[model samples]
Each structure stands twice: as C-alpha cells, then as structure tokens.
Target chain A: MNSEILNIPLNDYKTTVESLKNEGFEMMMDLTVVDWFRKKEPRFEIVVQFLSTSHNKRKTLKTFVNDEDLSISSITDIYPSANFYEREAFDMFGIIFENHPDLTRILMPDDWVGHPLRKNYGSGRIPVQFKNAPKVD
Target chain B: MKDYKVKKSKLSNFKNKLDFWATNSEEGGWNISSTDEGSQKMLENENEEQIKIQTGTEVLDDFVIDEETSDDERMIVNMGPQHPSTHGVLRLQAELEGEVVRRVKPIIGYLHTGMEKTGEELNYFQGPTNTTRMDYLSPLFNELVFSLTTEKLIGIEVPERAKTIRILMTELNRISSHLVALATGGMDIGALSMMIFGFRERELILNFFEKTTGLRMNHNFIRPGGVAADLPDGWQKDVQEILKVIPEKLQDYDDMLLDNPIWKGRLQNVGILTTEECFAYGITGPSLRASGYSWDLRKSQPYSGIEKFDFEIPVLNEGDVFARWRVKVLEIFESLKIVEQSMHNMPKGPYKIQDKKITPPPRKRLDESMEALIHHFKIYTEGFKVPEGDAYVAIESPRGELGCYIVSDGSSKPYRMHVRGPSFCNLQALPVIMTDSPIADAVAAIASLDPVIGDVDR
Candidate 1:
C-alpha cells in the first residue's frame, strides 16, 4: 500500500489524467456535473472520480466548464460503465459527453425535454395519476 | 405457460372494454344514453352511503396484455414492482430460453422522488432530509457523505467527541445495512432461516440506533459541522452490549449457511465479476473487495477520524455470490471492532461546531444573551451559506462507494448536487452477469448484488 495519495488541483485535469494513466489507473468510476451558479465565467464544474485497482488508489479530477456548451471528452473507451453515467449527466444537467457510444438518455426517456438538475430548472409538481393523493401535510 | 397465453388474451380484451368505457363516458350524449338504463338500475339497487370502487385489476390486465404481445420465442418474466424479493420496487424484464436467461433489461424509476434536485432547493441544514431519502435503509451513511463534503468545503473543524460519535454511528449503520442485505438477499435465494436470523440481529442494531439518533430508519443526526446532539447517557454501555452479543449471533449465521451444501451450491461460482469488470462498473465496498481489491475509504481516506481505529479490509478472489456474501459477513466483525475502539476513545467536547454563523446558540443562552437570540433567529430563518466551491466525497457504504458531489455558490442552498449511487452503477452489470445463467440463478445474482431500488432510481 502507498503511504500517501496526492491531491491534484482542478486546473490540471489533462495532466492529472495523463499522470493517472501512467500510474495504471484503468477505471473511471463516475463523472458528474456540479453547478456553482455564483461563479463568474465558468459556473458549472465537472467531477471525474477514478479508481486504480493495481495501486489501490482513488482520485477525483475536477474541472470547470462553461454553461454555454457543457462538454467533456468521453471516458467510455477507458471504462465501459462510464457510458451510462455520462448519459445520465446529459439527461440531468445538459452536459454533453463527446464521442460516447449510445449517448442517449439512460434513465429518462429520449423525449424528456429539459435538464432537471440545473439550478434554474422549474420544479413543476407531477400530477398524481393514482387514486390516493400524497398527504398535503 | 400455455395456460398463461390463453388467460392473457382474455385479460387484454377486458382492458380494451375498460378503456373504452372511461373515454366514451366523458364524451356525453350518445354514450350516456346507451348506458343509462343499466346505470340507473345499478344505482337504485346500491346503498346511498356505499363507497365508490376503483379497481387496480385493470393494471393487472394491462400487464397481461404487455406479456402476451411481447414475443413468443422468448419468455418474458416480470420480476417485481411489488414482489418482495426484488428489494423495493425494482422491476426487471428478463428474456429467457427454458431455464437460461438470454438477456435482462432492468426497468427502474418506480421510486423516483427527485432527491438530487430537491437537495438544491433545500438549505444546508435541511439537506440531510433529502440525503436520508436516497438510501433509506442506510440513511446515516448518506448523511455522512453529504456532511463531510460540506465541512470540507467550508473548512470547519468538528470536535473530537463529535468525530468519535460519527465513526461509531457510521459503523453501526454499516452493520445494519449489511444485515438488511443479508436478510433480503437470503430470502430472495429461498433461504428462509437466514432471513429470520438477519432481521432479528438487525432489530437489535436499530434499537441501539434509536437510542442515539432518536429515529430507527432516517436518523438526521449527522450534520454539516458535526452531529446534531451529544451522545445520550450510557450510550457507550449500549454499544458495548451490542458488540458483545453480535459476534456470537454472526457465528450462528455462519453455521446455518456458510458451510451448508445447499447454500454453497447456489452461491459459489455464480455471477462472477472479474477485477477489471468490477472496477469498470465502479463497484466498491464488499462487492469490489470480493474481487480481490482491498479498497476501503475508511482505511484509505480516513474521514471522520476513522484512522484512530484499527480494522482489516477483508478480500476474496472468487468474486461470485458466495464471495460477496462472505466479504459482507466478515465486515460485520470488522465494523464491531471499529465501534468498540471508537467507544473506548470517546472524547469530551461540544457536539456541533461552536460558530454562531453555522450552528445556533444553545437554548439556555437565547434568553440570557441578546446577541445569541439574534444569531439563533438569523441562522434558522436564513441558513449559513457555503463557500463558492465544489467538492466530491465518497464513503465505503455497505453496498459500495456511495459518493456525493456538491457545488455551492456561497449560498444557503447547494447550486447543484449529484449522487454517485453505488446501486445505480452496480446494477448495470446485471445484464452481463445474467447472460447464459439459469433464470433462478439470476435472482441469486441480483440478491448478492443487493441493489436497493431507491438508491438506483434516485
């Protein structure tokens, strides 16, 4: 077991990815977008969580992407499980995963019109189609 | 199978009649006039105070229609939305040929409560309520991940006593979560005795939890800076009593199933997940550990003062149903060790952070100090704002590496929140595991995976 795992900064995503690749980090566990609406230029941030089984190390790579075009290089080729996660990001946050195979909605249907996780997304109550409505209290 | 086909067609025709009645009844005139004589006759016979009846039998009929038209060459089996074995509203559409499952597509979203979006709208203090809903069975771990991330982002130092209490509660929750998985998983695979044993032991743990957190299931005790309140008196004694009793109960469980030929036959060499595959699917906790990977957040990252306690990360090379079960069972012992150590090293200090901005003043000071009263009023009305930053925190939950990613724009509420639910990720491997396996074995595979549908759907 390694004595210490390094905490890399968010600015050096490309370098960190290359370093992790060199260090035998073969799996990209999860990729998600966190929207920091208070930030000036790039209000949205992307978190790339990785796991290296050989070295038994886990690292989170963070980066800021503009809300105008939320795009990230696809890690599906590196880790097949990433396909669904990236598709989920697209479905929930409107972040586009470039070069991802089968990059359609995985959880929600294809026709789901809006990204539900964004800060500005309206929270319209979905009408209950069942007999007993949920208690109002 | 032949009998089902005949009944299914009859049910579909009945459903068509029901739909026609519903739609045509709204169109007025002709439809109402045609049915008026029969309706009037029925109304006259019925009592005035009789309750109106609506049948969910239509839903059952619709499912039969969906089953019949699905395809003849393939056998379509619906595994739960209500079935006890699916572990909570998870429905699977499995295509089978005889006993072998050809393909399985998991149909989720039955438990969708929009928790991630709800977290964004709620303030930091109220965030635990949303977290508690994700993994309802293991709510403390959900609260732990969110609280840890918020604390890291804001850079607040939780008191030593609070940290020790957090570790104790977290380990206890882990044991409870494993017991639930064991109970439900065993029942899924047709082991009735194991289910009873698992739940019996689980009730003891939940009893201990109720004493500390004031709730059995959704204990919103852990918060951003620290725990909600100080440990109740004699808490250490209760924990020690549980620690002393659980070891023997766990051994009884092992005797009942671990070496039994029937249990071994069903679990061994079933649903094999390779090391590469486990990593690819982002599998963690006991599931990943079973694949011979010794990755545990408590040992590796050491959040909430977990480094103070010593415990082993159990690993198995088989990576099958039995191996996963073994890892979880062994983890119960290790969690007990952590809990014992945490109790021994319990410190004395304030439970929550002392900052008036983050934590409200004590009730006694509200009447004494004007500043305390003002601070309490402000914090409750407009919650403390987090810094403008983002952080992702992951914990070794019973099922896997449950993670939370939060972004705060210096506001009381999170701008955006996303959960890296292990069940959601681990469930993706179901299709891979079920292919070519016997349809019965698919249930065992899913049971061993222990995918909670609430976590998956959220």
Candidate 2:
C-alpha cells in the first residue's frame, strides 16, 4: 500500500529523515506532534509525514518522546520547509528541537501559557453564547 | 542582526540575512535600509533585552549576529494583520533595501481555531465537522480528505454514488475557491472589474452548495462511510447551469485581464521562482503548476475516481504572478470539465455504505424494523469505530495539495488528525520567492499565492 507507517527511533530520527531525503522524499508533506498521553508510554509522538513525488509514495516517520524529556532533532536541515512545522511541534507539545533555524511558535501567541494541545491542558474553550438556543424563556 | 548567525548546516549557503524591522514610511509603499556603522538611525535597533520580552513563543537566545554593521540600507515593514491585500490576518515582516525586498517572514496563526487537537475528542463519524472548517474556502476538500483517510483505515469502500457526489461537489468547490483567488488577486493588483465579475460566478456556485448541503460554507456533507445525504433533486440542472456559465465568464476574463497591458505589466515576471525552488519549498497546486511542473495530486495520485475523468492538467513555465494567474484561470475551466463529466457519469445506488455498523439505517426502515431503529440510535449517539491504524491522503485543492493524516486506535474517537493545509505549506514559498523583489510586486506575489489565512493558520 502507498500509505504505510514506519516507526523511527527517537535517537535515529535525524538519520531517518536524512536517508528519506536521499531516497527522493522531495517534501515534508506534514509534520505534527501527536500527544497520546494516557495510552502510550511516551507522552508524545512527533509524526513526520513525507511524500516522494518521483516514486508516488507516502512514508510516515513517528518518533516517541516521553513527558519528562521532550526533545527531537530538527529536520529543517533536510527540508527547509520544516521551519514552521518544528516550531509548531515545540509550541503544542513542548518537544524542543535540537537545531531548528528559528524555533518560535508558529500558530500560538507568544505569551500563551502551557501547550494547549497537550492532553492535560484545559479544554481551551469558553461557553459564551448560543448554548441550547438562547434563553428567551 | 540575522546576517551573522553561523550555527552551520549542510544547506546554509546564502548571503545577506532576511531580518525584520518595523517600517515608519508614512506612505508605506516599500522601505529603505543601510548602516553608517555608528550614528543614530531612524529604524530603531531592537533592544536585545526587549526582543526577549516581546519574543512570542521562541526561547530567548544570546548575541550571535553583529548588531552594528557597515551598511545601514535595510528597513523592515509589516504587511498585515489588517491590510486589505493580504486576504486575511496574515502578517508579512519584510526587510527591504529601498524598493527591493531582501527577506519576508510570514507571521501567521491569528485565525487558528486549534481544530486539529480538538478532532481527537470527536469520533470517526464526527471528524468531517471539525475538518470541514479547516480550509474554509475549499471546505469540501477538507471533509473529503478526512473521510478518505478514515475510510482507508476502516478498510471500506464508499458506494460509487457517494464517491461521484464527492468528486462533483469538490470540483465545484474548486471553481468557487479559484474564483475567490482571481477576485482577490484582481482587487489586490489594479484589475478592479475582475473583482466584481469573479464574485458573481462564485455566488452562483455557492447556491449549488446550499442546495446539495444545507450550509453555504463548512458543509460537513462528506462522512466517513459516505456523504451525509444524496444529491438533492434538480442538482443536475444547477450543475449544468454552472458548467455553461463559467466557460463564458472565463472568456470574458481573458478579454479583461489576460491580454490587457496593465495586467501583463503588473503580473508578468513578478515574483518569479524556478521549479526547483517550488519543489524545495513544498509548494504544490497552482503555484507549483505555474513553475511548469505537472505534479497535481489529481493526475499523479488519483483519488475518488478522478483518474476516470478526461481532462488536461494546465502547465505554465513562467512561474511568475501572471503565470500563476493564468494557471488558476485555466484550471477553473478544467474543474468545470470534471463537473460536466461527473454529471454525465453520475452513479445510481445507495449514497453511503450499506454496513449498519458504519452508516445509519434509512428513515423508513426505522418505522418498520426494530433493528434499524436501534442501529440508528446507536450510530448517532456513539458513532462508528475505526480499526487501529493511520492513513495519509493528499488531494489537489485550489491553492495546492491538501492532505490529511488520521490515526485511529480502534476507538470511537480518533487518536490524532492532522490536515496538511495547502495554504500553510504553499506560504513557505513566500520568503523563498519574495527575497529579492520590489515591494509592489511582493503584494502581487502574495495575492497570486492566494493564501486563505484560515487554511494557513488551521
């Protein structure tokens, strides 16, 4: 199947990315951090998705990071496009990248407290209006 | 300050840093910059300690770049959290040398709804609701990709009729999205007449969407198993009307914008990028196509029976503002052609999966069959479960390749769902292409890029 998952070790994440780039994964399709808080041993999984336009295939490299140590090698060197994705990972999961060019939050505010995407973070919701049709009664 | 960072990498071979400084030009067309190596400068130097306080989300780092330089000929200008040209709340911080732009950093996330994280709380069936909102212009593509990924994981084929409906609706959506792109590009550049004409056709297509799905935007019609409902009666007539009207309108646009001297002057050779730069920066869809690469997901990676349709993928080699404008305009005709074919080959049968576990029983069945009543109740209340696995599906949206990655854990709710929004990835090409252009062309570049900030931020 074109859609397949490959487990990438936390330590070997950079090498895996480097090898994939050599094998013609032209672009990093999407890079996201999945927080499987209660289900998995490592609290975070840095999911890196790559697309090889030459071969017409998709490969997903997932590296696990525990809650205590949230860090991974940045793939910006392999793909300059990883600039924003890596920063987004840091913003949401607190997964510090080793060598990102600019590891600033891409989607969240500068002063926003805590990684809101973390499983433990509050709902990030506020019940303001239109709850069960306005209370005309 | 950025010109001096030397933390070495294999791909770090470039001259003159792409840094940011706020511009105070009363007219605010472009900017100017230089350094005499000593005296007071109007462009205030960012206080190192103050950048630490104002740094949004990056960890503060120490002195790396030489603060004072021999050349003080650069000025940074912020594009928009509110500027009309920028489609939405996209802020481009550019470092300029007089009229030429040296660097552009796109600061986004003003419209972030955090929908990806929230998708985990919703089950497989409820996924479309969250995803459809991601790419607000091409909402159906968002729903279609999410549904396709989940369907791949669950290992089920949607009924042929549903697949056909999806193709038809999304193709129509593609036309409307591109219309918005054309309109905004026209309004951003100096083609004011193109703006009014573009919205007129878009309004007609939106009426079709309202008929098929209840809502005008964010229609969660495409479900995991199939579409939420079958095509409404007389949808064929509406589809035919759209197909007939768009081609004629496109011909009119060709007259107004295509060969017009002013349009050519503003767009031609502006914001040029080679095919390698397009590939390197992960730009897809029209932007990549404009660079003369025919790497469309619909053609290369066929989905929802797009392979069966007969259409030509437009390719433009110029890779500039005018080339992208031409590329999108041509693709609209191609999309209209797909809608025509879909209407001709419309399948007749159930519009959703027949499996009771995945799809609810029909309304009439609820009256006669007890099992149907129970199944309908359970399906709506709890939703269907997807087997433990992940699927990544990419399809061509108007802006670029819109992809979605869904991970399920054999539970009702998803483990993770991520949308690789085309605008988000395509916007990366901005800094790469904008580093050496005039400021006016940079606006044209941003407009030609057609970044819907909702999609970019989401």
Candidate 3:
C-alpha cells in the first residue's frame, strides 16, 4: 500500500533500473517511446512500466532522450518480458536499445528503413519494399 | 554505365543459351524460326527480353527466396503464422534440443494495423475507433479504458446514469470476451462440443450487445465523456433475458468440462504458473487470480460506478490452465449477477454529459439557437481538448487488468497512448510453459493463454 510515483530524470535511467532490480521489481511490462516532435532538444520520451509482485505496486519511469542518438539501457537482463517490447519500440519509433541481445525488428521486416511511428514519417509509403511509385504530373 | 552494358551483353548470351536448351528439350519442343503466330509470339517475347537487356540499367533484384536450412545443432520448428491453434497470426521460432526447448522467439506483427500511431493522427473523439481494433474480441473493454483515461484527463464529470450504463455494457462484454476464450480454448484442447455450447451461449450475449450498441463485435458504445447514446428501449428486458439463460448454460459448461477426466488431465495441472512467476511477469486477470492473488480492479479501484454492483472476484488456488479456465467460468456467473443488479437498479437520466464542450448540444436546440449550432459543429469537428497531464486507468476486463496509459499535452489527440494488454503479459509465460512439455501441449498452452495477435502485435 505504500506506493509512490518517482519522476526519475533521463541520465539516472540505468541506475534507477539497477536499484529497482535490487528491490525485486522483476517485471518490465512495456518500454515505449512517445515522439514529442514539437519539443526542442530531446524530441523523444521513453517510458518504462514496471511491476513488483512483492510490493504489489506498479510504477512508470519516464525519461527524455535526444533525437541525435536515441538510446537507452536495455532491461532484458532484468526482465525477460521486455525482449519483445523493446524490439517493438525499436521497430516503430527508431529508438535504439543498447545491449539488447537480439535487437532486430519484431513488427517490421529487417530491411525497413525509417520507423513508421515517428511523427514526421510519411504516410502511404510502401513499407516492406520501400518502392516509390513515380508521381503523376 | 559502360560496365552495366557489358554485363547486359553477357546476360543476353546466357538467356540465348537457356532458350536453346529449352527448345532442344523433348517436353519444350518449339520452332525457333516459323511463320505461325505462336512462333511469332515467341519471337516477340525474345524481343522484349532483348529490350530489357538493351536498357542496361535494370538492377537484378537479388532476394533470398528461401533461406538454406542451417545444419547447426539447433532444430527449427514453426509454431504458427497460420496454424489455427495459435489463436491468431503468432509465429514462434523455438530452438529445441531433442525434447527440450532451448529458446523461443515469438514473431508477431502479422496482425499489426498501426492502431497506436493511427490514434495520434485522428481527433480525440475518433480515438475509440482505433482503440477498439486492437483487441477485437473485447472491443468495449478497449474503448472503455481509453474513454475513461481521456475523461479523467479532461476533468469531465460524466452523468451518474451514464456511468451506470457503461458499467452494465462493459460487464456484459467481459462475459462475452471470456466466452470466446472458453470456446476457442476448449476447441484447441480437443473438446469440440464445448466450443459449440460456449458459442451457443455467447451468441445470445452478442445478440444483447447488438441490441444496445448496434454492433456485435466492435461496439464503440463507450466514448469519451460517456456512452455514445442512451440504451435502446427494452434494453433492460433483453439483458434480463440473457441473465436468466446464461447462468444455466454456464452451469452446463462446467458440468461438461470441469469434471471430465480428459479435459481435467489436459489442463488441470498442465501449464502451471507459479505465483512468484506470475507476479514476476506482471500477469493479471484470471491468470493472476488463479495463482491465489485476489486483485480485481473492480474491487481494488472501482470505476464507472462498478462499486455499486454486487459481484465477486473469482479466484482459485491452482495456478494452471485449468485454474485460469475455472476463474473465467466463475466470472461469467459473477457478471450475470452484476447485470441482474444493474438492470434492477437502472437509473434514469441523460446517457452522456450535458456539457456542450464535450457532448454536442441536442439536435433540436441546434435548429433553434445559433450558439448551440456552433457548439455542435465545434464539438464534432475539433473535439474537446484535454488538460496537459497523464492518467493510467485499469479495468478488470475479461482478459485481466486491461489498463490504458494516456498522456495529453492539452490537445485534441493524445500525445501518447499505451495499453497494458493482459494477453501480452500473459503470453510472456509461454516460454516457461512450453520448455519441458510435449510439443502438442504447446498448442493447448498457447490457446489457454487466449492471446489475440492484434493486442500482442500492437
């Protein structure tokens, strides 16, 4: 019942994850990126949701990462459930998962270039083949 | 460009050699030089090949059509991309050693439809249309979770009657969704009769839903601020009829499957999920409850006037596939009780919030007042904006703790929306469940988890 929401900053993501692992937060429900294209500097926000059965509590950790090299510590070592979700985040938002064992695409094909979930991604473009049909004048 | 032209000449020479071989073969005897139209057509085909070679810029698309099966010690077995027992388009590449599974990597997204990204592009009012498509079996649950989160962020006070009606519809949806799992799970385990019986009762429930929401599967009845419209006339009567029949049918299902030795043997102790492991995977709903953790969102944190309903959160001590099945069957009865109570205590008032900002003004008033017309147009076109904040709402859906986390930046569309789908969490236990079990049991284990690929891939 003693639950509190902690707003940890982006730099402390690794340390916070390590500490939570020590505290028996064993499950990583999801890790997703929210693209705030309208923002400056860090245009992408990473959200990690965790649950601790011993404490019967769930907490969401949010952090901002720069668009230049959007990477974060992969939590696969701590929570095996994150294996698919992190791959999905990578496939959709183009956020890289540092040290992920198999960081290949989960939702899209291996040859897909641009992430489709990014706000600026062009719509109606062919996904798998990436073939651009000639535009009519 | 000069190098490409040289390669094109060599490619033409190769094509000429292939044509010569084809013509010389007994099965493919054709005249190389003849005046017949068929021979002329063959010449024209060769001319087109010459044109392709003359272009000299065509890139030979090098694609690996079929990957050469590796001779490494790893054994590759495809669980399903199309197999019926997979529940949906879920393909798992499991690395096995003899009879033991070494590692399993699930390949999803065959059912992906860009639902989350689509939600961001659409207006807030159109959000339900996208959310309902994620978990098609439990559309009302998806819409309700999204609507509640958006409503909480927007600070709109939905009418008491609207909240009651929402609860009523969602509880019925919970039963309907569980029935789908039960029927399909039963069929997956070789009990074909159970599927027929389960669907028989489920059709009655879907009939009630169609009466109220005007749709059988994807009922977008629950919307932001409240329900889409008031319940149709005699809605209570129709719901009461279902309550009267469903409990008896559920009893018959229990009698048929609960004590059958074959069904019990296949599920009672198979795919056992320990309490510690269930918590570690953040498992919820029947799967969590079957492991002896009595956590139901309806009792822990009631929303949409669910606290007023009289129902029990069904739980079991056995953390196996059978236990999960039992928990769901018991929940059907519990839902029926809630539906009967809601029907008896049905409230009378407007079904949606009266605020012109959220709900449009009445159609009659639109003709009379210019202000009403403008408000209606604005509400429909632009949609109401939510405050810049985030809220996570969890509901005890038939599938488990179905939660929606919404982040709004004071815009008509959600800045970010994520679903804590029970199927996705429950499916995490599959690798552990199938590690030592026979390969056939893997299919039953997956079906018992009742994963909808739409939810998983999204």
Candidate 4:
C-alpha cells in the first residue's frame, strides 16, 4: 500500500519505465507535466505514476525537461496506455514525446495556436462572447 | 465465489499461454495468437504486418486518417460526438467491413475546459470547486483528491470525525455512481427497465447528497484540512433510509438483467480486455477488477479511515461488459456495508479543522473580536500558503484511479495542478477492446468504460 516517489535522470527516464514495467508495474495510473517557469535549470517536470496491481503499490517517477529541449523519449513502447496522456502533455505544455508514433495535438482543437499551459500564456485577455454579441467567426 | 475462483485460474492460464507465445513468436505486443495452431500462422502473418507497419505500407496508428484504406474491402464511420448511446460527447471513428469493426478510434477534446490551467489561477482554498466539476457524476472524489493532495503539501491532518464523515459520504457517492453506470450502460444495450431502476436508486442517493451538502452535484464540501460543513440533523437517518431501500432495488435489477438471454448476448463476451491488455493500457478500477487484477486504491492505499472498514474487493476474471456490470452490482453491497459501519461509529465533534490559520473563524467570532474578523478577511483574500513541494495523491473514483498532481512554489496559488483523470486514460483502451469485434459490441464496450467526457477533457 506504500506509494514511493523517486527522481530519475532525464536520460534514464525511458529505462526506468521499462524496468518498472518488467517489475510488475502492470498499469500507469497517471502522467502529469508541471511548469516551474521561474527555475534556473529545468523549466518543466514530467511526473509519471505507475501502479502494481498485485501488490497494490504506487511508484511515481519524476524527470526534468527544460524549455530549450522540450523533447523526452516516449514510454508508449512500455505502456501503450500512455498514448493519450503523452499527446495531452504535448497539447497542453508543448512537451514533445520522441518516438511517439502519432504525436499531435490532443484535448485541444488541431488548429489552435500555442501551448496554453505554460506559465507565460495570458489568462485574461481572451474575449468572452455574450449572448447579444455577434459571432466572431 | 466458486465461479470467480475458476475464472481467475483460467485467466492466469491464458496469460501464461500468452507469455509463452510472446517468447516463441517474433511478434511483440498486441498480436495475440489464437488458442491452437491458428496462433502459429498468426505469428508469421503478424511479423509481416509489423514489417509493413515499419515500412509505412500499413499505417497501424489508430488516430490518423489512413490513405491506404481500400474502398472495396472496408469503410469508415463515426459513431458519436453527438450520438445518444455515446453517453457524452465522445466521437468514435470505426473502420468497418460488413458489420465487423476493424478499429474504433475515439476522438476526444470536445468537452475540454482548460480546467488544469484554471487550477493554477485559483488558489488552494478554491481548488475543490474547480476540481469537483471534472467528473460531474463523481464530483466528491475530485474534491477528495484535490483536498488530499493539498493536505499532503501542507502536512495537515483532518479530525477523526471528519475522516469518518468523508468515508461515509464518499461510500454513498460510490453506490450512486455505480448506479448511473448500470443505468447508462444498460440503456445503451437496450435494457430500458434497468435504466429506469438504476436511475430510481440513484435519485435516492442524490437526495441524501442534497440534504447533506446543500447540492445534488458538485458539492464542494471537502476542503484541505476537513469538510466544509457538518452532517445535517437527522442525516444518519437519511443514510439509513438509503441503506434500507437500495438492496431490494438491486435485487430487482439483478433479476431483470443478470440472467436475461438478450442481456447476456449483448454484454457477456463483448468488450473482452484481458489482464495483460489492462496492464499495457494502464486501465484501472472496475475495468481492471473485471480483468481479475484486484487493485482498488481504497483497499490497497487506504486513505480517510478506509483501512478500518471491513469490505471485500469483489473481482471477476471475465474482463467483459457483463463482468464489469456484475462487479459494480456486487460493489454496491460492500459500499452499503461501509455506510452501515460508519453510521454505527459516528462521532460528535467539529467538522472542519480547528486551526485558525487554515480554517476561517466562525461567523459569530467575526462580530465579537476584531482580530477574528481580520483573520477571516486575510484567509479568504490571500489564502494560506503551502510550502514548496510537489505531491501526487490518487484515489479510486467510480471510473478508476483519479489522481491530483500539485506543484506549489510556496505561494497561495499552485505552481502547477494537473489531474490524471481515469476517464482520459481508460479511454485509450477503446481501440484495443473494440477492434475486430462486431460493430454493435462497440457500444457496450464504450458504455462499460463509463467514461465521463468532462473528466476526459478536463
């Protein structure tokens, strides 16, 4: 029932996932991207959670990714269920998943411009259409 | 119980065969051979198909629009985004060949609300309101996860009474959620009576929710340190009323759907996802339990006094729609048991935490003391700050493992707040389960997943 959290090297992230899968991390519970835009070295952190069904244990793995090199090797090879989540990360944070067969925008319109999750994205400027207002499109 | 054991052993044997086949065959994942010699030939053909996929001759990617799709053999169709049986705004693109589904690609994002980004904008005190709407059906779980994660960040503990009350409310909500699953899933497969019966039972639970939390849905009762309010007068009787009626109604639902020939035909063998498939896709909750892997966060990673409760984790090895239905119906009995235990052990104490820094002063204190008024004003406006740390707290929602990952930079607002929604992740298994099955079974498959689009797109 104990949940363990570890910080693995970015280069070893793929290997860690593979080893964890082999070690009976039967399913991935979740994968999230965190933006620490003010930090000096790493701007983004990819937090991955894997679950052992038999043991009822959870292990969370975190790896750092900077804005400059936003790419991280995909774990879809080990966990096929990570496909949608990786795509969601790509859509929200623009953190690319390398070796992902179909890495495109998900959870967002395909034509939408810029990643909306980065800290710098403007939160208030978008105009809200009222009932009486004419459609912008 | 005997039947469950037999099926579970058979499933383990099936897995061993697959493991044996995996090592012997050159083909890797997702290419399962048949039971006998059919598998030998499939191994060879699967290798060729892998080569084609590598060379771009066969674009096996599910999401893309394939140009190589021949017009003569198969045709493509979209099931929903607007269709009724879809349960929500989920679009499934199915490639069909004479009523057989080749692949079903679920197109999501129609309900996207940018909730994660909005979480960062809202301070910790307002986190529950934002998260509660993620899974509109199981809103309390969303609040629970957000609250649990925030508590982890701040290192605060709820009172014993608060924990028991949380356990009580959430267990009731679980039964309510499972009822909706039965209703919508049964309705999808053409069981109109089951839908009515399911909703009837759900109404009773929702009524109790309305009485306790002041709202039927999206009750932001749970907060970081404790719940927002205490149980209403005679609330225990309300829970006891639900406990009285649900079991009898469940019996009615079982008699109607469990042994019906048409119900069995539609859901028994339809949407079979084996244990290995669940592992590969990271699917959990009822779907995983139906697949024979008994991993529920309540049982495994106990939180909010769940460890003290005595309830069995019902599991089935069939990994089919019927198995999921059966598991959910059985789980309601266990939830009822939890409610009964909680009622017997109910305590009398303050519901919210007593700390002045965390919880606002009572309204009476505001008129009596200027310091109390100032404290309340500061707490509401600025919100209490959490130390710099990152934490992920996952709880078993009705659908699956719903997790909240929060990164705080010692600010009232979160540095980042991302939800690992079960609906979004469980939806990935759709293509795997729906492929090669009949087109009709796809409806049952999706309904069995019990995915709420709000949770998927949040």
Please give the TM-score that candidate 1 achieves against the real structure: 0.82
Please give, for residues B1-458, the per-residue lDDT of candidate 2 as tens digits.
Answer: 35445545322432112221233222222223332221212123433322222221211111123355335777777777789998888888887776676556778888988887788888887889898888899999999999888888888898889989999999999999999999989999978888999999999999989988999999999998899998889888888899889999999999887778988988887777677666667888898889888888898889988899999999999888889999999999899889999999998999999898898888999999999898999998899888897778888888888888887888899887888888887787777666656787878988988998888887
Clashing pairs in model 2, backbone N/Cα/C closer than 3 A: A110-B56, B33-B72, B33-B73, B33-B74, B34-B71, B34-B72, B34-B73, B34-B74, B35-B71, B35-B72
User: Tens digits of per-residue lDDT for model 3 on B1-458?
Assistant: 99999999999777766666755432322443332321101111223322221111211111122245344645867677788888888877675555545445466667777777777777789889888888888899999999988888887778888888888888888888889899999899899987898788889879988888898987788999788878888887788778888888887887888789988888866676766666656677788888788878788767888888777887798877888888888888888888888888878888888776788787799879999888888888898888997777777777777878788888888877888777877776776666545566677778777898888876
Candidate 3 on A42-94: residue-level lDDT in tens?
Answer: 88888877766566677778888866788887876666567667777888898
Pick out the ten consecutive residues of candidate 2 chain B with the lowest summed lDDT.
B54-63
**Shift in Å, residue B356, candidate 3:** 0.8
Per-model C-alpha lDDT, please? 0.77, 0.80, 0.75, 0.83
Q: For each candidate, what TM-score against the reference? A: 0.82, 0.85, 0.83, 0.87
- Sliding window of 10 residues with minimal summed lDDT for model 2 chain A: A128-137
Error of 3 at B98 (Å): 5.0
Q: Write the per-residue lDDT of candidate 4 for residues B1-458, one digit (tens) a residue.
A: 99999999999778767865656532334343332211111112223322222221121222334567676768878676789888789888777876777755677888888998899989999999999999999999999999999998998889999999999989899999999999988898899888898899899999988988999999999998899988989887888789999999998888887889989878887778777777777788999899898888898788888999999999998888889989999999999999999999987788888988789988899999999999999999999999998888888888888889898999999988989888888888887777766787888988999999999998
Can you tell me which runs of candidate 4 are displaced by over 4 Å?
Answer: A129-137, B1-71
Task: Give the DockQ-based CAPRI class for model 2.
Answer: acceptable
Worst 10 residues of 1 chain B by lDDT: B52-61
lDDT of 4 at B194: 80
Each model's total of backbone clashes: 0, 10, 1, 0
> Scoring model 4 with DockQ, what do you get?
0.34
Query: What fraction of the native alpha-carbon contacts across the interface, defined at 8 angstroms, is recovered by model 3?
Result: 0.35
Show pairs that collide, candidate 4: none
DockQ: which is higher, 2 or 3? 3
For residues A26-49, write the lDDT of model 1, one tens digit per residue: 767678876655545576667777
Best by TM-score: 4
- Model 1, B86-117: lDDT tens digits are 78877776766666665566666667778888
